[model samples]
Target: MHDPHSERMSSTEQRAAAGLAAVFAFRMLGMFMVLPVLATYGQDLAGATPLLIGLAIGAYGLTQAALQIPFGMLSDRIGRLPVIYFGLLVFAFGAGLAACADSIWGVIAGRVLQGAGAISAAVMALLSDLTREQHRTKAMATIGMSIGLSFAVAMVVGPLLTRAFGLAGLFWATAAMALLGILIVAVLVPRPPRALATREAGVAPQALGPTLRHPDLLRLDFGIAALHAILMASFVALPLALVEQGGLPKEEHWWVYLSALLVGFFAMIPFIIYGEKKRQMKRMLLGAVSVLLLCELFFWQFGGSLRALVIGNVVFFAAFNLLEASLPSLISKVAPAGGKGTAMGVYSTSQFLGAALGGLLGGWLFQQGGVDAVFLGCALLAALWLAFAATMREPPYVTSLRLALSPAALQEPGLVERLKAVPGVADAVVVAEEAAVYVKVDKLQVDRTTLERLVEPAPAC
Candidate 1:
């Protein structure tokens, strides 16, 4: 048996992981930079209504939602880098077009083209293709952290960048970043050592049934969608509210965002630690959703007070950050061992679609009844989610592990049970067709050395 430790990440893996994470960050930053200021700068565009402004803000999600899965599947058939390059080209073109446009409709058209790039899944797949199994989790986690960091940076930078160059300048900068991503893919990311012999790691048609029918996973999907919808939808009114209620300058809003985000993030740490340590994830999750509902109510109650607005920002973001960090792990716990990727793809698609819906609906509400109406809508969303989520069972206190397998393990009828018998393993599933076994285990209880040996097959005579 090949020593499990022998598969340490090579230089190529190190470079690929770093390069791909940077690439994902660049693209995400471009999309997010507009969020904090769109309601303000969108006013300068021709024929802009509150509704159309909201549509432009979210137009990218419409195309992104429609194409995310198809691009992932397409990458499998055609090749990862080719699809990525083409998508980047579309994004750059869209960004450039938006930069040059004078009208809101033109910006909307460009955003649709931008979303047509839809290369997130392809990039993630490329990350998988480039890294060893042991390093893949670390690689994916790095990319995830980059995304979260990018959003925080965009909040602060968007207003500053707009102050310097106006909204079109932001679009031009996005186009430049997209071009840089193309260069990164070509130069920084290394080609896989060999062509993949199978598509097992990619989402498959067979996994669709089990993933689709899952009640708990579906609830998580709804939660993610609701999360993003509230996020985008709130932007439709948040900035304007800050200006009208607090008498703050438009650019000055960044201070509120940056400070609130920092405090909110720090506030979330203890909850996360306590939830994990005590196996009380369900309780904290419910608490977070309830906080979301209250945040909206607080916004309505104190929309006119500057001090209250700042405090409200901190609390709202605190709750948002908590749920944002927790939801993915919750979904992973509920997903079928073999169908994790499919379930995540659906989750992502729902998230993008929710953004589109929220922007459209949120804008309409603001136009009809003002900030109070917008928050009321968000509160209703939170209420609905709370009602459904209340039915969910507590998340298992386990983390997932992936181990390489050999063909011989497929013929061992009792292998899964034997794996399950391992003291710390809550369950095990072997995908013989994929030459991999996945397990859920409590790290505190698992005997690491024993599990490592089991992951490798017995040497043949």
Candidate 2:
């Protein structure tokens, strides 16, 4: 029979996970809503050159990358809800500013402000605070799905919205969404429960040293950066290519985006399932990276053919979705238990940095070398990522568990040693003042019943 405690824990964790994901999706939707239409829309504004248009499109990423870590640290001091509310307010302000802008430079400034609202790191840290260690991976996965869904929706909706109401209207809508998000934060999300609010002793700092010094973690971080860079760079070129070479109108670009997203979603599921269930995550990741490289190569080879471009887009998005979902999980698995938050903070920062650089660099490259050179740059990034990815060790599946014990129990000689010796327990640490035990265990082999029995009510009590 299944344990009721376990079931109840699972359900609560799922709710918290879903709630956090909704928050992320709502925020991302506002940002992504402009990407598909930005290049064309910028033409209507004053001083709208290709470089300025690219700046408007990617400026948010620059601010986001710069502020992610600081926002996370701020959350640690001022609390998650306060930081999130501040971010939402900043985002709304930027949206409203962009909506009123008559110049491309003004819009670019607004986008930079929008990016400064960077709350992803805070959101992830909040998830860590709310959920048990055993369920953190599942929670993060839900957030990943929310991001992917938001991106897909934004790609389809961005062009249509641009056609229907124009760029200003879209920005106004985004402002409205951001305002709504603030309401959700206030009315919907629960206050952090007392048990979850208690900090564990011995948890290490999540700093640049730990995040960047580890070879494997650094590899994953670089991959995320490169992946996002390619994505942003592709957007800089693809719209013009579609209109000029594919003979597609600007408004009809939505159809291409919708089709690619749909096809990619369906095609990626089998590979993702295979990776998780068959323990072939490493191999699948490498394969996905290879597919991305191939897509870049194809784009380079068939720059003028609409059919070939569409095919390449489908393959690219499929791989992009797969990597987006898997990379965080891989980071969580491989990171030291004490520093997962730091590793993720670093990863998120790198991702936005890449986005910012992609747009700026893509604009320059497109202007200088045209479409072929753009794809060549993307291919080179993918090649470097593939090499680094190939060298990474398969991440072991482990989960962390937090247990509160009496001071006497902790003082009991060899208590931690005994826990460490338990069948699946990989490591255990006892924090005396907190009267807590942090345990790392292999997911498949952990015997919850055995651990629970050890902590059962004392005879006198």
Candidate 3:
């Protein structure tokens, strides 16, 4: 039977969760603060062109995507905090370099360096070490919330900062934030035990092959890539549109983003509730994707009018936020037992790759045909993603569990088969080297007592 009292997160877990969430928030805030104003203000740099400016905006993603997994693996060898410390210092140095740059290419180089400081996987590994398995979902959710909040704050703050202090000032502020993040991690976060640090938190090289080839996982990965591509591409044109076509003054752009994000956030709540509580995730996903497609089309067709642009943005963010929240949950539900870390690593890489491509494509299209071309291109990408999403199977509603195994139990043959034979147990993977069983089970139908007894079998009479 489940113990209700065991569900509460311990004080140590709470501190670790809060500290790590703040670390993630600071880093994300630095990255995102440049997104809203770069298209407009970046033009003032020497040798700036439509394509180069687009590259400047998205250059970090290229390095980030390529190095994210490697950094995580590095942490496994050296320890998580050392990797984190090095990543933050590299990020700060990159931001300082951007702050001092005089040309668009210099800025791009700085952004590339910023992305080289990839620490997302390392941070997640540390979080896994700090919290028990049962409490991990809550810890991860906290970090997710922090990222979402930072993005919202960035949308409003980016323009205001640029207006106050110019493009270089924004990069300077980002450097300061990265430094602050280092301090937070050093002071607030505890070091994980050596044994727990190397646990299931880090990626397993052996799991990567199967994780990459998973069809459903591939679809979701493509969906994220497309979503980010559309985002980066739209921003390449959006700031310019707001000033020229929409007649929104440069200084007042923050209000539009503030209002749109607020409306979109409130609008997303009902769909989230309907999707999760009612188990209508596939329907919710399809509906959100359909809504995203229409909004892109709306941008392409009517973006010239300020009213239409504002309305389109409000709706766009509504769908974007929904899809952003839903995709990770779906990945978790679909991942093979003991393989989620690898699955998520690949998904994140695809997402960054999409951002890099989106920037390049958006810039080229805009140069060829202006704002209309960019929106049209995004619409086409959205349509392609919609087609892929339509074919995804309804994901299983199962929870993953990890249980330790005794030495004697490890010697028993057919242990995995026996666990899978239990009612409501969906899948089981027994990694003998780790002396652990990773299980997937339907909570409603699964008998906890039976599951527990099977994992730690009683001594023979």
For candidate 1, lDDT tens digit of each residue in 1-461? 33446456777877898898899999999998888998888888998888888888888999999998899988888889899999999999999998899999998888889999999888888887887666777787788878888888888888889888998999999999999999998899999754342322356677788887888888888998898888887888888888888888887888998998899989999998988788898899999999999999889877787888889889988998899888877766766665667777888888899888888878898899988888899989999999989998887777667676666666767878898988878878887666777777778898555776876668878
Which of candidates 1 and 3 is the stronger one according to lDDT? 3
Task: Name the lDDT of candidate 2.
Answer: 0.80
**Backbone clash pairs in model 3 (N, Cα, C under 3 Å; residues 3+ apart or in different chains), count:** 0
TM-score of each: 0.94, 0.90, 0.97
| Range of the 10 consecutive residues with the lowest summed lDDT in candidate 3 | 193-202
lDDT of 1: 0.84
Better of 2 and 3 by TM-score: 3
Error of 1 at 284 (Å): 1.9
Query: What RMSD does each model have against the real structure?
Result: 2.3, 3.3, 2.1
Q: Clashing pairs in model 2?
A: none
For candidate 3, write residues 303-386 as lDDT tens digits: 888998899999999999999998998988898898888888998999899988888888888899999899999989999998
lDDT for each candidate structure: 0.84, 0.80, 0.88
Where does model 2 exceed 4 Å of error? 1-6, 9-18, 128-136, 194-208, 412-420, 427-435, 451-461
| Tens digits of per-residue lDDT for model 2, 200-303 | 21123524576679999999989999998898888878887788788888999998888899999999999989988888989999999999999989888886
- C-alpha displacement of 134 in model 2, angstroms? 4.7
- The residue pairs found clashing in candidate 3 are none
Relative to the unseen true structure, what is the C-alpha lDDT of residue 112 in candidate 3, on a scale of 0 to 100?
Answer: 91
